[model samples]
Target: MQSKKIAIIGAGVMGKKHAQTIVKHPDTELVAICDPFSDAMAQEFNVPNYKDLDDLLNTMTLDGVVIANPNRFHVSTAIQCMQHGVTCLLEKPLALNTAEALTLIEAQQSLNVPILVGHHRRHNKIIQQAKEIIDAGTLGEINTFNALWSVYKPDSYFDIEWHRVAGAGVLAINLVHDLDLMRYLNGEIESVQAMTSNKNRKLEVEDSISILVRFKNGALGTLLASDAAVSPWGWDQNTEENKTSFAVSPDQDCYFISGFEGALSVPNLEYWNYPKDQSKSWSTSLMKNKVEPNKEEDVYIRQLTHFVDVMNGIAEPISSPQDAIHNIQLLECIELAAKEQRTVYLEQLQCFKKSA
Candidate 1:
């Protein structure tokens, strides 16, 4: 098969990562780059850089474009690419808010162009294995989930003005990834109750938050996140997916899920259940087993391969725009819950007004 030609938009950290992965992948070719601010990444990768999306689109015949631009430009860029009939691997937070996301959702529904939202964790072998295990009924009738994402970012990391602002807080910046994975692994969230605090950093944005969620299936979940605490109990810390950005906590587990038949811990994939021969009671000890995931592959590479499949019509997007919109709605519900000091149902959000 001929290599698929791919272009990257935005020359930031994520764009550079995608460029590197594309260059290395045997099935992909790095064609061009579009970024208004910087051409440094384009120069490093030895690709022609254009300052505008239209210029790049008109010049190059691209099979797919990786939209790794800033959060604000996500929806517009994706729409532009789809209008040109190019597939996209759009970075997450598909839009600034649920309302903005709805616009993209509508464009996608009308255009019928494939867009793979970059909820990249879904490509991790560990997560894939966990999904299979759960789907196989290994953990029968999931009842609850407990997840943690607490890590103390260095004080200097917040020196950037935006880091201290409302839109760049831990909930939006960090916890969104965890929440996406929760919804991916568990199920759709029905409602949420949440609390946020910024006392640790005294910034305009919250540094810590606690959320309670009720899944549509009646399974409950709790997520505790803090960017101001010193802890090694987050997906980034436990998984080596982004070691350059986060220190690894080799022996820790970040998610604990339980059900009537068994309980499971994430990353480590430890399984706990009573042996069939033994009596199902508190008096008997539960058997412990390790569920091994497939050999590790770089998640970004996996995501790109999947994007290629999506572009070729061989596979549907694992994280479609419609699916990602729910994640945005979930975040909005949490924000409303925290702001109003009350439980917020996912259906209450205005983004759901049309669908509901």
Candidate 2:
């Protein structure tokens, strides 16, 4: 079987993960990894590596590229890869801002190539089952949803240069995932009222953010994210008392969703379809399929595999550059609402208005 050649930009933690995925996947070969900090990640993955995007592009014959660089570098790297006719699976938030993300999207449309965004949460088995339940109308009308995402960023994390960027902190890096998930499950966000602060962390970007969002379908979604907790991870009943940190237990990482008819939780993507009085409330369940808990394989592998598949004409790309643009537009709304202490209307995302 012929394998597709792939290049991963940014030899950061995430970049190395994508490289490992490419090397392991049966359908792809990791041609090279590019990053200015290649030395920092030199031994992280076994692959042909480089220190610059241009070097990798010039040196290798590649079918796709993975943009796992800093948030600010996403647009330029994606544009470069796509302009060369290479499919890209870009890391989330799309870009540092909506305008840049939209520009890339327009360019992507002209190129007519698949550009998939790295929103791995969208591929979680539990989340997939929840979406199926919602579409099946087993949940009835979705009235309310709450997404809580919080973690303590350690002092070491602050040492990174990009971590200090104005728009690269928790809001764009962390909450963007939940925000995208909300849109994935419920629908478009129509408006948002938000609040954010950096009271605890002495950083350029806000460490904590909370937003009240109204979905177009009238579903109320409340999303929260923070990196200000004393311990990054919360107290666990099973662990020793001293085990208080940002390290999340696999069991605890699960999310849940509730509706008029039933509720669905991680590990148990089950649904109680019947009402209180109707035939004992029918219950259907799906057991969690535990794949190897390797971060590289679970998230980055599926992401790269999806990208290679699209490039090879095996599967259609699921997340388009337009999706990334829309997600970034939503992130922009959240940022503005939080900064100004006002409700940001979805229509106000004209900053990402399609260019003529």
Candidate 3:
């Protein structure tokens, strides 16, 4: 089989990561790059670097494109790529807000182009295993989810002007990933109530947030995150998925999920339940079991491989645009809940109505 020719937009952190993964993957070829500002990566990779999206689209025949551009440009760039019938591996949030996300969702539905949103954590083998355990009723009738994402980013990390602004806070930049995973692992969120604060960082954007979510499946969840604190309790720290970007806290778990029959902790995959022979009551001691997850494969590589499958029409996108739009809507509901000092229902959001 021939390699799939791939081009990447936005030569930033994620763009570079995708380029490296693409080059290493057996099924992909790095054909070109599109970024108005930088060509350093393209030069290093020995690929043509076009400064314009149209130029890259018109000049090169690409089997797929990865949109890792700035948040503001995501929808427009994705529409352009779909216009050329190119599949996309769009980076997350899907868009800055639900309205923009809806436009991209509508475009994909109309053009029949596949878009696999880069909620790359979904590809992690641990997550795959966890999902299987839950789906198989091992954690029967899940009732609660508790997650934490706390870490202190270096002071210099916020030196960029945009980093202190409304659009680039812990909630949008960091917690969105956690919230997406919550929705992925738990179920659709029916409503959300939240509170946010920027007192610690004193920036225009929030540095800490606490959210209460009610899943459509009757499960309740709480997410607490802070980018202004020192801690080792986030998925990034616990999973070691990106060691270069985040320090690993070995053997730590970031999520605690419970149900009537059993309970599970994430990353570690520790299972606790009463013995089948014992009486199912508080008086009974719980047995601990371990679930081993495949640690050999890199999630980004798996995501790239899945993207190849999406491009080849062999597999439907694991994270489709319609599926991702809900995450964006959930984010909006969180922001609204914090701002209004009231619970925000997902079905009540205007964007959800528009999409529906």
Candidate 4:
């Protein structure tokens, strides 16, 4: 099959990742890089650079684009790509808020262009294996989850003024990821309650958040997100999933999922349950076994392959626009819950009014 032409829209950190990964895949050609601030990246990659998306769209015929722009611009850039009939892999947080996300949703539905949201964790082999275990009844009726992302960033990362501001806080940048993961692994969230504080940096936004969620399936979960803690208990820190990411401490358990029959710990992929044929009882000793997923696939490679498949009419998107919209809407409810100190239902999220 002929390779599809794709362009990288942002030259920042994530744009760098997209550009590097695109070259490794044989199914895609890294046609160009577009970013006014990233001339160095363009020169290093030996690709033509366009300071504007309009110029790139006009000058190059691209089958797709990967958008890693600021959260506020995600919707608009994606809408432009869709209007041009180009497929897109838009970075997460879906949009700055639910309203901005709706504009792209409307455009996508009306135009019938494929716009895949970049909730890359959904593409990870380990996460897929964990889901399959739960779905296979190995962990029967998953009832509770301990999901967390607690890591400390050095002071250098806060040098950017926007990094200390509200929309650029840990909630938008970090927590939005696991929010999608929870929705993906569990199911629809029925309600959420959250509390936050900025004791660490004392910035415009909270530095830490504790969220409680009730899944529509009757399972319950808690998500903790903090950028101030000096620890190594997150997906990125625990797995060799992506070597380009910083490796923190040696591996440790990042997730603990339990159901009626058994429990599973992530990264370790350890499975625990009472022996079969033995009566199920608290007194019965539980067995510990390592549950290994099939050898992992590079997520970027898989996602890029999937994107090419999406462009070629071979496979559907892992996270479509409709599915990813829920993540942003849920995030809205989480913010409201933290502010109001009350449980916020999914239905209430339907009309949440963001503060001006």
Please, what is the TM-score per model? 0.98, 0.81, 0.97, 0.93
Which sections of candidate 2 miss by over 4 Å?
A: 36-47, 159-168, 201-204, 230-246, 250-256, 266-297
The 10 consecutive residues of candidate 2 with the worst lDDT sum are 233-242
CA lDDT scores, all candidates in order? 0.90, 0.69, 0.91, 0.84
Quote model 3's TM-score.
0.97
Residue 245 deviation, candidate 4, in Å? 4.7
Clashing pairs in 1: none
Tens-digit per-residue lDDT, 8-90, candidate 2: 78877677767766778888877677877645554555566687778777777888888888877888888888778888888
* 1 against 2, candidate with superior lDDT: 1
The segments of candidate 1 whose C-alpha lies over 4 angstroms from its true place after superposition are none
Q: Where is the poorest 10-residue window by lDDT in model 1?
A: 347-356
229 Cα displacement, candidate 1 (Å): 1.1
Off by over 4 Å in 3: none
Candidate 4 global lDDT = 0.84
Say which prediction, candidate 2 or candidate 3, comes out ahead on TM-score: 3
Give RMSD to native, each candidate.
Answer: 1.1, 5.2, 1.2, 2.7
The digit string of per-residue lDDT tens for model 3 on 116-203 reads: 9999989999999999888989889999999999999899989999898986887778887888888889888899999999999788
Q: Candidate 2's error at 275, in angstroms?
A: 4.1
What value does the lDDT take at residue 188 in candidate 2?
A: 80
